[model samples]
Target: MSITVQDMRKGPEGYAWSRFGLPEYTDWMDESLSWKQTCYIGDWSFLWQHRFTGPDALQLISDYTVNNFETFEIGQSKHAIHTNKDGKVIHEGVLTKFGEEDYMVHGRGGYWLSFNLDRGNYNAKVSQEDWFMFQVSGPNAIKVLQALTDSEKLLEAKYMHAVPVTIAGHDVYALRQGMSGEVGFELQGPKEFSEEVYQAVLDAGKPHGIRKMGGRIAMINHLEASYPTIATDYIPAIFDADMADYMDFFLSSMPSFAQPAYIAGSFDGQEPSDYYRSPIELGWAKVVTTQRRGYLGADALAAEKARPHRVLRTLVWHADDVADIQNSLLREGEHYDFMEMPRDQRGYMWADRVEINGQLVGTTTSRGYSYFFRKMLSLATVDVDHAEIGTEVTVVWGAPGHRQKSVRAMVQSAPYKQDRSRGDLHQSTAP
Candidate 1:
């Protein structure tokens, strides 16, 4: 009854969830370079999608989310987060407005739509649907996409935008969003056409040097891109009553083999406290605008605008120090401290409580190897003082063994990788 990649698809290449799909090499730099030098196709159909329609759909959404959707144009997408009364994140997703009364929301978690429906104050209806989503990335991604679609206007589509186009004679939704920290596109289409679209990209990319990438390489890219993932890189928001029920369902439904997976945060089967975050802590303050009228969690978020507790910062671990710890265990018969990767194909790690000088200063969430930066990096929520760049601190890694070791780590900017790709996407010249 648990969720498995096989539950999503099957093949000799297996599903993108296959551990074998990851690069055979361990170094992320080489793997990422393979994509940058050529191209990489990723299977992203695991993301959940929901469709909303009806006369009251706009009103229903406008009143519940922090972002203003009143002026959203058709064929455009906007990112928004739904929070509980206490301002804890419920779900984050891209809102795609197809028309005045039709829209689709895509996100990692599935319960947000259900929670909105359960509230019963809105007149619109929500229903979940199955769709296959794929991400084509690297230098030549746009070329491959352009070959498949006949729409000449696609070349003009800007970043963070979406356009309806025909691909291989099938209608597909192509978004200019990418998680690989590269110039790319996300192609969403019907579940039945999943393999066709996947093959089309592979075929068109053959001349351009496209390789299939797995979750391991994708984790490195996410780290470099500074994109945060729920249930792996951050604590799951457990503030709302219906959201609590959804979390229970997710945990209970997980397959027996996946039981050891880490579930973030302390829900404890009760309403969450004020210790949770507003949009600011999640590094999403840009989307929070108070210029418009009232919305859900607006007042609370407005109050937090004046006084924000913790800011999101990046931690870069010294390569020599990390290597020494590992070598100590292998060469000197000493056990090295274990640091968890952000998204392990087998399972995930819980957020580690961080302390500095005997004071509870922060919590370290997303941690991964940055092949491009050639160092280990992590995303943390820390107090104002500890959040400053160049601040040094100690982080406790690994589960409690016979002996637990704390390693020295330093705070840096959130995005360890320079966002050259984002800039390149907007440039007139080809990447």
Candidate 2:
């Protein structure tokens, strides 16, 4: 028998440095709260990295990226997206330009970029780099960071800008960015300096109530911040007939665990190809400027942009229904798949089918608990007509042919967590 997507059910099952680096540095709940109450530090060294160089590097990037490239500059970063000809997102990640023709990417975008660079008529060469990433985020993040580097220069560090700094007497690249949607910085440097910078941040952050964040609570930041991630939110676009050979090689090269994808939702797409999403569907339509430098699928995306489609939104589950899941666990054998704290499903998209008035209109991704909001929430995509705030809908919270229960949820604005990261450094920040 051929392999199937359900095989992804066998995720990395263990509690150690295996997936969650610290397991629970100080407990998932407390760590989840550190970013809201004070500050939190996270290690993301294991996130893949890729570098590209050559005269055609920028051209290669421009051809594929949907974001504006005219303003992209050195030391600046972008939430880069890669999509198939159908305009559905293939992969995306954080991309930074080191020069006009030099670029570095942090995430799975490497694999797709490499594949294209090898076949396209470009002089660019791709190389995987070993970089260590350490994040310091929260209301007190600036203070802790200022204590370590040039406060005046760091003060100019705006959102999404990468700056150079020295920490623990080691030169490091400090990127003023955060997935937590808080005032924070993601510090990166050579792999050898990981320990040095990590310890220094922990020590300097002591006065700010810095807690070491782990894998369990790390992704919670995405929900509050509204940052969509690959795999967990959408399947990688590699199953199209045109990409058959590429998919075969890509699957063979990836780890056993990374091969299978866990698909959940009411869409009932025939295969991964049918599940691919577009920029408009993901609520990234704003970045799809058609009257400019052409990128991959620009014409097709422009055509689709003019049409109506489902858009991404946030859902606040009903308090009563959320409580019933737990209440059911106590009375029966197994009820409602058992909602877990921090996040419900592990390493897989907790996608559920979304509906409005008995009509299947959308799907949900990234369901989890937010210690800051004290509510269970999820990021979802629904028809543009039903994408308004305060709109009521139903979310089927279990796989088909298995135990399932429908929960009531209301459409809410995304980045559900208030935007306070842009607040002044000296102000008392509250979100």
Candidate 3:
């Protein structure tokens, strides 16, 4: 039997975080609020890192990604996306340029890049690196970092740009990139200085009300901000027969926690390939550049962009209908799949089928409850015609072959929370 992704679902189950450093430092509800009201410090050292160095490093990156790197400057970072020949994203991550020839990638994209580097005739050499990455985000995030370093220099680090700063006398780079869709800075440095840098931020953040964010509610931020993550929103496009060799290498080299990916909920894709999504479908068309060609999936992306069938949007589930499903658990013989609070505790995508007039028109993924908004929101890729704001749809709740319920929903613009990732730091002050 072929080793499918479903076959790799080994135990260590409930929210599988044996490798994730911190599951919860405080209550998840309070931590979730920190990024919106106060501030939060999240440890992202679990993200895999890769270093590429050579004269041809830039060429290698430009040839593979959909991004145009002609203006990518040193000390700047990009949400780099790697796609297959079909324009479906394989892996995406934060790629930063430290020097003209020095590049670092933090995420699964490194594996794909390194694999290609070995196969292609390029002078660039790839090696893994050990680094510590922590993100401080919220309206009050600037105050915490300002207290630790030169406020002027800290403010100089524009969004997606990195600036060198010292914390507790330890040299580190502060990158202004908010994953929580708020004013935030990512503190990155060598592994040795991780403890001191983290402690310094904790101490500095005390007065400003910084909470140590946990893994449980971390993805709630992604849902609110419309950041589509791999395995959660769309499966990687590397499981086909042609990519079997690469998949083998990936499974052998990666940790077990990073390997397994299984599908659930009501979006019944016939095959694994049906779950693959292009950049255009995922609301990342802005990131795809076509000024020049030769990149993987360049032609496919151009065609798809011109006549996109579906677009990503946010869905506001009807409160009463959601309550009806939950109420079923109390007074029914066969009840719907129990909905987890905040978000699904399991790491599966938990995708649900979306429809209009009883016709399947889209799919919903990344469902979560935002205490800040007091509403249930989810990301959906619906037909372009029905994707307009206020379009009414039905989200089929529960997995296939189970008692399901039709929950009414409305199509809304993505990033349900107003985006403040690029808020001016000078004006942002802690209360």
Identify the leading candidate in terms of TM-score.
3
Number of backbone collisions per candidate: 2, 0, 0
**What's the lDDT of the predicted structure labeled candidate 3?**
0.86
Cα lDDT tens digits, model 1, 138-203, are: 777777777788546566776777888887778998887767766777888789988888888889
- How much is 379 displaced in model 3, in angstroms? 0.6
Models 1 onward score TM values of 0.83, 0.92, 0.95
- Cα-based RMSD of the predictions, in order? 5.9, 2.9, 2.0
Best by lDDT: 3
C-alpha lDDT (0 to 100) for residue 104 of candidate 1: 86
Write the residue-wise lDDT of candidate 2 on 116-179 in tens digits: 7888999889998999988888888988888898887678877788898999999888888867
Count of clashing pairs, candidate 2: 0
Ranking of predictions according to TM-score: 3, 2, 1
Query: Looking at model 1, which ten-residue stretch has the lowest summed lDDT?
Result: 265-274
Local distance difference test values of all predictions, in order: 0.65, 0.78, 0.86
327: Cα error in model 2, Å: 1.8
